[model samples]
Target: MSLCIENLRAWYGAAQVLHGVNLVIGEGEAVALAGRNGSGRSTLAKAIMGLVRCEGDMRYRDVRLVGLRPYRIARLGIGYVPETRDVFPALTVRENLLLGERKGTRFTTHEAYRLFPALEARAAVKAGLLSGGEQQMLALARTLAGDPSFVVIDEPGEGLAPHVLAQVAACLKTLRERGVAMLLIEERLTIARMLDARVAVMGHGAIRFDGPIEAFARDAQVMREWLFVG
Candidate 1:
């Protein structure tokens, strides 16, 4: 497995967000994490990335990840594209990609540009100046520049237009083709369907359901109880 978690718990200050969550992702597999707002989907991503105070067994290819620092976890070939799209505002698009590179990474700035031509067109422009969709592309491209074996992306389709969302989905498909494992966090199943990924639904800080996407689509009870808001 690329990632394995057992009894995972996470916290921000005194408030606990994750509750004994367990999940696994195989090499080159994509799992879409779906949930309503505040259901701890983002918290799970943060826990995996070592960005939150977490406990229990969290491993990336047998490496213990529970107590590691964020940068250390990142160096272990785990990449994160936050929901906030935290690109370096002062840096140019090309510079941002350069900053994400690792010594032995197979992905390169040139490849990132090829994946997102809009970024290539604005290579010299500061990241802060890019449009929302363009910034989202840059964020994903920059993470790819690191050549991680696994990535945790939060809300890739949030607030994006249909055309731009399609472009992002295409980029993710390319990553899957290259055998990169991913944990895609989102509120809806649209992008998950596009990626042909398995679905894991979260509720009350725990996984309510974990199964094939087709199975998830067929399970109306699970959706009404865990995914839909009354």
Candidate 2:
């Protein structure tokens, strides 16, 4: 099972952003989408989750997903961790994570706790009171607690201290080992390199570079042309 897209296009109130983007992510594969700001990387991510109006073939595990609502997509074991940390401000850390649990689900917060020890240390604390880094962890943990088969995670390293960033990286690595497919969007090329994922560089609302990360990394001309080296 995997996500397969063909000429995906998106619009925001008549303003088209994504123009015929195509990509793929097989089960347990991690792929990074990178480019300069407004390159349609995030727009493509939102389109996959049906958070915006889109056209073209969007399939997940062989099921068409272009017209599905965001919640419907989520129900199919696809998780979206937006750029914002969508936490219940007044809810305790445990409560926030528990809220993500669905009936008959096998995933639990115990795994989340193992991924970010700080979350376990403050299980009873209000989520709003945690630092930016901890809140990011909570948001991710909460989503993963539902046992998503595929995840689209936007930039999670923004505004975090070095140690906290490392924690996020470790958590992602763990998820990969657990066989969760991932679509990652990040500005830091170094972080993208760490995932050993194929790189899809977006430009002008379309994918301009699609290949192995090493291939993308080695091409100084393409890297600089697409804002990867510069």
Candidate 3:
């Protein structure tokens, strides 16, 4: 499925963050959204998932998504894993993943375990006690369990150790190979490079730059101006 956003605007109460943002992630494509804090990257992600008040077009596979409830949007095969890595404190890892399951068959629990062995190993443990990286894995695995055609993942590698990060990357690679579209919001340039993804730089609630990573790299001005790199 394809995800297309055009002239998107979002607000938190009275504060507007995204200012006419436009982006598109075609089926089987992966795109990275990078920016400094308060640049509206997270807000845009939330808007796409119907988690925030939004105006403008948010479409997936030709169907309009604006004004839909968050769950309704998920029902359309779009999954969101927020940056917060919120897991059920009282639920076991298995239970948490089961909660992500849908009525139709998708990524089965067995497949999820194969993709994320650490989660399988700790299936009986309470999700709240897992390490931060583990929690992030659980969150990603749970979202993928729904077999979403497209996913909006926020900061999946925020604080992972090197090994855990590799595991996470591998899991995501499987999804990419399966042609699952992804919108990844991340601060780490390395993640973008690893995915070999097109890059979009957001600044002051708008997309300041959108192009191949190579172009963004070649143009030092974009990094300096939008991202504060010297």
Candidate 4:
């Protein structure tokens, strides 16, 4: 497995957000964590990336991830793009992308540009000036700049237009082809459906269901119960 979590638990000032979460993402696999808002989906992402305090057996290819600083985890080949799309407003697009290079993984600028042509055109522009969709591309580009073997992408389609979302979905597919595994949290089903790897349904700080995407689609009861929608 590229990533694994066993009995993961977390809290924010006594407001627990995760409980014994168990999951595994095989190498090069694209898995989605589908759930309603405030269901701990993002929290789980933070926990895996070591952005939040947690107690668990978190492992990335045999390295223990729990208790490590977020940057330390990133150095271990874990790239994280939070829901907020943490781009540097003062930095130009090129500089923003350079932040990801700290991981020391080799990747050509053209390689990232191929995944996001818009970024290529805006390379010299400040990241703060880009539209929401473009900023998302920048955020993802920054993560990919590191040439990470695995990524945790939170809500890539959250505020994007239909066309832009399609582009983002395609970019994710391209990343998967490059053998980069991912744990994707998405509100829209289209991106998850297109990826069509594995699915884990989160609810009330725990995994309500974990299996194939087909299983979630076929069992509407599970969808309605755990996901709160189809």
Best by TM-score: 1
Clashes found in each candidate (C-alpha, N, C closer than 3 A): 0, 0, 0, 0
User: Per-residue CA lDDT of candidate 2, range 1-230, in tens?
Assistant: 58999999999999999999988889999999889999998898899899999999989999999999988999999988888878999999999999998766556888788778999999999999999899999998988888898989899788889898888888888888889999999887555677798888899899898899889878887668888543
- What would the TM-scores of all predictions be? 0.97, 0.95, 0.97, 0.95
Indicate whether candidate 1 or candidate 2 has the larger lDDT.
1
Off-target runs (Cα >4 Å) in candidate 2 are 104-106, 228-230
Tell me the alpha-carbon RMSD of every candidate: 0.9, 1.5, 1.2, 1.7
- Model 4, span 1-230: residue lDDT tens: 89989999999877889988989899999999988998999999999887788997989999999999888898888898999998998899888878676545556567668777888899999999999999998898888888889999999898899888888899889888889999999876678898886888888888888898888789888777876654
What C-alpha lDDT values do all the predictions have?
0.92, 0.88, 0.89, 0.87
Ordered list by TM-score, greatest first:
1, 3, 2, 4
- Which of the two candidates, 2 or 4, achieves a greater lDDT against the reference? 2
Model 2 gets an lDDT of: 0.88
* Count of clashing pairs, candidate 3: 0
Error of 3 at 166 (Å): 0.7
lDDT of 1 by residue, 59-174 (tens): 99999999999999998899999999999999999899999887777888888887788889999999999999999999998898888989999999989989889989998998
> Which tens-of-lDDT digit does each residue in 136-223 have in candidate 3?
9999988988889999999988989988888888877888899898989989766778888899999999999999999988988888
Clashing pairs in 1: none
State which candidate has the highest lDDT: 1
Q: Return the TM-score for candidate 3, rounded to 2 decimals.
A: 0.97
